[model samples]
Target: MAEYSLLIVEDESTLRRLLEYRLGKEYNVRTAENGVEALALLDEEIPDLIISDVMMPKMDGFALQTAVQEREDTKAIPFIFLTAKADEESRKKGQMTGVDDYITKPFDIDRLISRVNRLLERTKIFQTQLDAKIGQDFSQKLTPKTMPVVSGYTTHFYNVPKGHGGGDIFDWTETRPGTYFITIGDVMGKGLQAKFYAFSFFGYIRSTIHTMLGATDSPAALVAGVNQALVNDSTMEETFASLLLLRWEPEHNTITYANAGHCRPILVSERGAEIVTYSDIVLGLTPNSEFKDTSISMKPGSALVVYTDGVSEQVGKSDEMLGEEGIIKVVQNAYGHAEPIDAMVQGILDESKHPEFDDDVLIFWLERLTSMDRQTPRWFSPFRDVAEGS
Candidate 1:
């Protein structure tokens, strides 16, 4: 059986010690004399379950539960009110406060233990199901279902989500004829929570792009619009996301890109592979953040590679990470291959020596095919009205 941790907060010294001693046998337990001490302990380390008294000096159980529920880090911890108050009003208040379980005085220790076990087991099962559902949704929606076919350009992307989903997200759309807008981002966490945040953040990105259509064509302006929206939203005040936006113009053979604390993209051509040099603060940091766009000229057979940190941070067999420099090497080696994007992914997997990555892996490759190379017609239309000759 797994050893779960529990926190017991009670005013009575004898009762606190007795509960701790009994619960300690099945689980690791910590005790506190009052809500203040319980909060202090919580700051140090969050426990799986919190059993607290309703009445105590300094801070009462209701106050302590409010504090715990308000914090993002501690809000999810299961709570139980074990107190002497057995009134119907007290139980109603506990229920309103969102206590997972409530036990009155003269409670049987065996019954209490059983309730604790059931609550913990239920929480574990709920988390597992939530992760599975979120992972399925991520696989279906977070990544592009099909690569857009642009005239004079060949596009390819690969996304491998980590266990139960991860934070990486990417999207692309043709803003105008011969112009394509692409955005890649990574939310600042992992697993189901990060995946949830990624979906929300990506929604903001898409909304901003559409809201600013025809108003601005600069990548920096689009990124700034998204940042402003994120920072101004109270719910997203604590959420931070690294974003990279690119505007590709096939007729001009140029790409104008803006980075918001994201990994710099690599530009691979006949000469060699090199990283694009431009970046700014991440989104949700501040509304006043400034973003700048850098334009780079591309030649035939040239390609741009944008990816999440998962690729650059992969730990290799040497126990060292495959940093940006290693990524450049992978792109360079894969250049000119019949399937360069697949070659790059295989090279990365070979170096990592892992069947799957620890973080979500997303890679977007855009190549300006040469005249001699086979070309495909543009079949993707961003606007139905425009496609229908309206």
Candidate 2:
């Protein structure tokens, strides 16, 4: 688990030091003399919990809390007020401001610590629940597990769980005889909301793909339709998605794919493995978007890997990131090995295990160039975000 950082914002230097010393026993604590100093600290790094005095020189605790609530990044951090005034108006004002907890002057050390710890724990629990919801929403609406006829080349997926549910999703459907439409997407955000956005984007892609099958049967048109649909949806205005829509035309022995705000697909051939980075705004975040399609002819032994940021973001135990270069190195090392794509993914994941995940991870491997009349991707329901778009 990541260490919780507590920020103390009291004007008195002596009280700040005493509180920092006391809280440092349990949490990583930082002290600031006033709201101005506290804001400066916040600009540097966000603390998990903030303990501020109600009265101060430049920025008071009330003003700080209000500012925090107004900002998107800081609004979620828990806030607690420390006030010498114990009047009804003060208490009511603090409560109305959504103060997680309050401490009166001459507070018992043990009592203050206990309250802070409880609030911190509660904040953690809320974050966990939110993340779980995102995963559930994605799985419910658009998981590949739910599909009947799998699309594209056949490859087993490795189990690489993100501590929180992530925004990565991949699905497929057949457009014609010996031709399959595959879609992969990553939604912006963390936890369930990310998953929710993924599902919404997946649904739009599925419906649009189906419609395209009856219309032009062009990969570019299909991508354009999907992008327009997502752009038109008001619910997804704040949320954006990166997508790669692949169409396998076996008759031509070629695969054509269009990208929208998604990472480029990689082709692992006998010669070498290279990333293909052709992408155009993650859908919904922009309008009147123009997307481009790329074509690649596959050899018999060739394979395609579509992955989320998680695969590239594998963190080591020492807080070191296993970046894209590391991922490419791992992939290069696995090449020509007897291991299947599943094993390759698992090996990468095994090499990248940490105590916790910074974000959700997903790896989708597509094998073979020929047709496999297998099941496609399935649907998962969206978690209703009560906070917004409710």
Candidate 3:
């Protein structure tokens, strides 16, 4: 029942006006003399559907359709071609451009209206279904349902996709009691395709972790394993991903991490916030890429923060990005709050003032709790003792 907008591009004044007057009764109609004028109007506002004539003075319907298809915003709009030439060649050309319909001159007005209505309705249905599917997939696959509970540490994560879905993914597993392995990555691109690709990439990462968990505890080795798997797979040969792998060993009070072209993690302690500088090439780029691990000792009350580019690249009021420096400031400010992780996430959101992000936003915070702050029961003590060879 939503009133759809339609653009009619025809050189003939009488026929254009007649179609507009008739179509205007059921939907919003706008008329243009040729494809050039139609494109100008499109810059101001995109219509739900476009009906264009095959021949015109400045730009014809085929040329106009190509121009519209070139833009990301206007490419999906339903298009119909109207023409005096009923030749098979012209019809084939229009079809090649993916026009919704082609009607010859002396076409029935009633038939034209019916085709327009059917195309618009089909488009609406398709969009609705796509949105629903993306929403469902995002909730079920891309994000963790609950924050991880690790002994001697407070762990929290926050994620918001740009729209219905995004490319960022994060997951954690308790390799052994009191020891955790975490993986965070961003697939290259956006929207539904990126979301699905991320799922596939994460699947490979998970399988690598499970198969190698008993063999080695090195993050760099695990990252190299994942990269090799991706390079070997024909389906993922062209896919690129930035991965950050971290292993938290509470017994050692240290975090061992490896990066694959991902953003450097921020370490906040008595020395102050500083970026961890170790990095390597992204996954799926080369077959024999090597990843190096960096180990950082964490004192009680210290925290480590990792995030996707969306957080650091957020545009501020001055049209500048809130880069790593801005994120460090936010993390430092959140230290005094009862829930530092939640406060840090909120601080970034308030600073950006963006209701929706341009890319997928993800923040993962891990804080080593001081002895005085340890209130939760230690459920991993048995596993901890075994890991320590006691």
What overall lDDT goes with each candidate model? 0.88, 0.74, 0.86
Error of 1 at 260 (Å): 0.8
Q: What's the candidate order when arranged by decreasing lDDT? A: 1, 3, 2
Q: Is candidate 1 or candidate 3 better by TM-score?
A: 1
Query: Which is the winner by TM-score between candidate 2 and candidate 3?
Result: 3
Superposition error at 79 for model 1 (Å)? 13
lDDT of 2 by residue, 85-176 (tens): 99989999999999888888978988988888888889888888876765665564565663323334455454344536567777777666
Model 1 ranges with Cα > 4 A deviation: 1-126, 374-390
Error of 1 at 139 (Å): 4.2
Highest TM-score among the candidates is held by which one? 1
lDDT for 380 (candidate 3) = 56
Model 1's TM-score against the true structure? 0.70
Summed backbone clashes in each candidate are 0, 14, 0
How displaced is residue 59 in candidate 3, in Å? 28
Q: Which candidate is the best by lDDT?
A: 1
lDDT at 331 for candidate 2? 64
